[model samples]
Target chain A: MNEIKIFSPATVANVSCGFDVMGFCLDSVGDEMVIRKTEKKGIHITHIEGFNLPYETDKNVSGVSALAMYNDLDLDFGFEIEIYKKIKPGSGIGSSAASAVGSVFGMNELLGRPYSKRQLTEFAIKGEALASKCEHADNLAPAMFGGFALVKSVSPLEILEIPSPKELYATIIHPQIEIKTSESRALLPKEVKLEDAITQWANFGSLIHGLHTNNYEIIGKSLKDVIVEPHRSKLIPYFDAVTKAAINAGALGSGISGSGPSIFSLSQGEETAINVKEAIEKTYSKAGIEYDMHVSKINTKGIKILN
Target chain B: MNEIKIFSPATVANVSCGFDVMGFCLDSVGDEMVIRKTEKKGIHITHIEGFNLPYETDKNVSGVSALAMYNDLDLDFGFEIEIYKKIKPGSGIGSSAASAVGSVFGMNELLGRPYSKRQLTEFAIKGEALASKCEHADNLAPAMFGGFALVKSVSPLEILEIPSPKELYATIIHPQIEIKTSESRALLPKEVKLEDAITQWANFGSLIHGLHTNNYEIIGKSLKDVIVEPHRSKLIPYFDAVTKAAINAGALGSGISGSGPSIFSLSQGEETAINVKEAIEKTYSKAGIEYDMHVSKINTKGIKILN
Candidate 1:
């Protein structure tokens, strides 16, 4: 295939108790990338759409990811790529990951699918690093592999796909604001109390169990962040009011997605998801913040080919 | 019924990556308590068996647990309790938990089963506090609720029972040595690197997934403790060699059990558990340390009543 079109879904990282370790894919909101083989020896960005991202090969996330894949494969051919960013950048719902993951995913298809999903994720990390200054796979892994992915170790690049409940629905609200990923990350505490850390671990363990066993009650009870969110949520407007509204409206759990400006709530069914969206909308609307809302079931399939 | 007999199984706390928050029950080792109603006005310990534990109501774990339950229920009737302690004290295999749990369990039965398993765990925590000077339920929860239990919070005493695979077996080795729990706990660093903590959470998340899904490979890979084990293992003789031997003999995971002079390994079936026991025996025998070994399937039933 000389040309390939790929769509990489948005993702929610941290997932409350699982900071820097867990994430899950979304079905509806995503970024699209088109890659076509070229006679030139290096990757190039020929066109851009939606957000104004860098076009330079070394600077753009897509270009960086494509170049990494190309170097790993030792491919002789070059590729021209175009990115249509639908998941707005810096929304904290894994916007950059869609670009980074889509680039490697599409490039792999253009290069005859030489790399596995795990290997593609590894290449995509370089792109994520370009954007965030540090390589993290919590977003990239789920965006590449689909569903819930756990980054067990970054050094050895161990990523495990956690089995998610089928009825899980996500409701995300992206407020028209930007929270720079680096600055948002800097807000987290350097050292966490050992007591709080143990509680977080227990909740994380319970969350995983609930996801695997389809126990929504356990999931709801365990969906608490005693560490990161307590610090980072301050950056988002009306975070507490919005989350309380979502929970009162029957969301199983709610929290700032990734690093905020986007907040999400999870529920069991589509109707409840829609209700959660409405609840979040009421809060954001009252706060006078323009927001985009999406309600859909979890994306079990991550990146997919687009005709 | 005027008299009731109860057996509370031993438990292994920490479980590698989940320090102070996770534990599982053992099938073979435990404590037995027999409770009988009396016309007397107060709770009493009539007979003590095995180890020479304190017989005072406030000092003995069994006596403390029974008194806690009696006070909670506001019962006017008196009770006489007999303790038969098979699990060694300070063995780090939750010996005190077995006594505390068995006491509350037998008392609950004798008092007509007024308390839920969760409530029983709460009362048992009081008993554990009498022994350890802190109210912790990692061991008590599993000993009360059975299988694997995660103590998500101690404030309101929230415990979640985690599903375990049927073939999971535990192999425990108690070397003839004493490592005070307080001293071992003090050896842990007060502050952990955020990076290592994140990795630990990932492993913990993966371990939960592995347990629920019966995925042995994921369980084996995730059964790593980077924080507590590295510092505390120095207190146990032949810790490294025994763990290496167990892993080489096909034990899926091995680590120090709680604050230990005891170590445990987990495997798929009874045969593998026996092999792990043999592997541990070889190492300890070579080191000239007398050790007691027990291999059993994961205990699904925490406390059982006997005639």
Candidate 2:
């Protein structure tokens, strides 16, 4: 296939207790991209739509990520990419990750599947670093491998794909404000109390167990972030009210999607997710903040071919 | 129904990455007790054997735990417990937990099992606190519930029972030295680096995923303790050497069991577990330390009726 069209999905990182390590893919919210083979032996971002982003190859996340993969391969041909961006940058739902993951995924496909998903994630991380200014796979893994992803370590790049329950759905509310990943990350403390760290890890382990067993109650109980949320939540307006409202509306749990501004709730059913979305809409609307909302079933497949 | 004889299993708590939250029951290493229904109104410690311990109800862990459950219920009959202590105290192998769980399990059995394993664990925690000087259910949860157990929190008393892979076996070496749980616990830093804590929780979540999926390689990779082991291992002689030896001998992983002095290794099969046992025995023999060792399958059932 000389030309291909793909849909790269958005992702939610730092799922409650799994700060810096966990993330999950979204089904409906994403960006559409088109890639075509070219005789010229280099990468190019020919066109872009719906969001102001650089067209320069080095400056664009898709260009940077695709170049990272393209440079290593001794291919006879190059590729041109066009992104129809939908996810807003710095909305905390892995906007950069969608762009970053899209190019590499498209290139690997056009190159006759030369790289593994893990290898594609490595290329995506370079692009992601352009936005976060740090290397983390929390978003990249789920965006590549789909479903729930737990990054055990970054150096060796170990990512475990956790099973998503069939009935699980995600409700996301993006309050139309930018919270840069680097700036939000800087708000965290360098040291945490050993007691609080223990609590955090316990919750993380329990949440993983709950996912494996399909126990919604256990999953709900374990969705607590004792370490990072206390400091970061202060930056997001009405964070507590939205969380309380989502939980009261029967979400399994609610927390910051990535860093801030974008809040997410996980529910056992689509109806409950929609209810959580309405509750968040009411809460955010009352707060007088312009916001975008989405309700999606957990995406089991990451990047999909639109063609 | 009147009298019950029980064999309560030993447990290894703080399984590597799951420090302060995870534990697993052992099949061959445990203690036996005979609990009899008495006409008198309180817990009684009638006979003692195998080890020096208190006869007073309040001082003995078994009697203390039994009393905690007994007092909570308005029952006509009291319990008479005869001690058959086989596990050594301060050996870091949940010795107190075995005795503590034994009486409560037997009483609940005789009392028609009114208390759940979770409730029995609550009673057991009171007895465990008498030894550790802290209310933690890492050991008690496994000794009561059997298999791998993760105590998510002690305050609300949440315990999750994790599935044990069928081929898994444990090799434990008790290097005849005393390291009190309270003393070893004090060795930990009041604060830990945020990066290390993140690594710890990542490993913990991955370990739980490995257990649920029965992926032994992931289990081996995840069996790491970054926060607690570095300081605690210093308290145990030849800890580094034992761990190195166990891994070299095909053990999945090794670490300080519970607190210190006693070291444990997990292996995929009984043959590998026995091989790990030999490696540890040989290493300790050269180090000129007197020690006792046992090889046990993962005890899926916590307590047994020996009749």
Note the B-chain TM-score for every model.
0.98, 0.98
For B1-307, candidate 2 gives per-residue lDDT tens digits of: 7999999898999999999999999999899999999999899999988999999999999988998999899988788999898888888889999999999999989988998889998998888888777788888999998999999888889889899999999999999887765678689999999999999999999999999999999999999999999999998899999999999999999888998788999999999999999998889899888999989999999888886
Q: Give model 2's docking category.
A: high
* Per-model TM against the reference: 0.94, 0.99
- Candidate 2 residue B238 C-alpha distance from true site, Å: 0.5
Clashing pairs in 2: none
> RMSD of each candidate?
2.2, 1.0
List runs of model 1 lying over 4 Å from the truth.
A38-42, A74-78, A110-112, B74-77, B286-288
**Candidate 2: where is the Cα deviation over 4 Å?**
none
lDDT of 1 by residue, B8-92 (tens): 7999999999888999999998888888988886779989899998878888888888788888766667899898889999898
Best by the lDDT measure: 2
